[model samples]
Target: MRKPWCSTSSLALALVTVIVVGLAGAANAQGAAPAPAGPPPPAPTADEIKKVTEYYLRGKDVGPILMELVVCKKMGKSAENKSICEEKHGDTLKKGDPLIAFTRFFVPKGAKYEDLKVKFLLNGEVRSTSDFTLQESWTGYGNYKQTTASKPGTWEILVLRGETQLATAKVTVVE
Candidate 1:
């Protein structure tokens, strides 16, 4: 019953209304709240946090631990002289005497990670480099002894974890 021209006009109007509505929806979506400033920090899972807490409570380390070093000479020709015995044994080192390096690594109980390599530096030059760990056979924690070069200079212990230097201890050798 509708006229032909009137029907075509209605169809055109409907199409225009649809386009306007679509445009309004697009505008509303664009005006809405922006996403966020930057990416939010990644949320750590509950299990991950619990594991970290457990490790901290039990004193477990991942990266690096504390290191202690002492440089000294033997007391005399006693049996203890052949070994690193007491602190007094680590006094000043003399020429032609034994240079003992006492080192202690702070780690969890039963953790025997021997990834530490130490270099005995005499006057900024590497005299010796070796890997050692806690040993029951030794008198002290980690006792490393070598004959003195009979040269008066500076003595340094460079502690390295992999290629990185973790700690350093130094002493002076006298004639």
Candidate 2:
């Protein structure tokens, strides 16, 4: 009887030891590695990043106007602007006109053209605002022409649907 009791106690102690070791191994595995920390990854840019601002003119959903801004360092070399002086049809602007044009993109998938509102902002302040009505579709490519009132600093083109702001762009204006 004494021998059997001693044998059972030894088996129980061995089992406890094994259980403790397995629990320790699991704890170490759970704390094995730490996650990396840093700023969010940058947005991918195209080889030619066409900066455009969208103006939501009509509909319940406003979209953005897109424009391309030439960066100063690559201005004379990489950037190219073809003049439309050949015929009267291409002359969207008169001589010595101070205006910036942008292409608009609308939102909410099937929104009509007559239901949007668009606005332009300079350094977080409103510079010009406009409204449009879509007779046919919800969104299409369009342009907004704004004459420069003062030397362009930091300008933002914002699109809105009703009261919600959809998208925005920040561009530096050069004299």
Best by lDDT: 1
Taking all chains together, the TM-score of candidate 2 against the true structure is: 0.37
> Each model's TM-score, in the order given?
0.48, 0.37
**Could you tally the backbone clashes for each prediction?**
0, 22
- Kindly state the number of residue pairs that clash in model 2: 22
What is the lDDT of every predicted structure here? Answer: 0.54, 0.41
Residue 167 in model 1: lDDT: 72
1-175, model 1: which lDDT tens digit per residue? Answer: 8657668657755765565466446533433212236889896775764453344335434543544565655433444233333443343566666666555444432345566777878799888888765421111133454445467788777777678887776666788
**Per-prediction CA RMSD (Å):** 25.6, 21.4
> Model 1: residues >4 Å from true position, as ranges?
1-64, 75-85, 88-92, 134-149
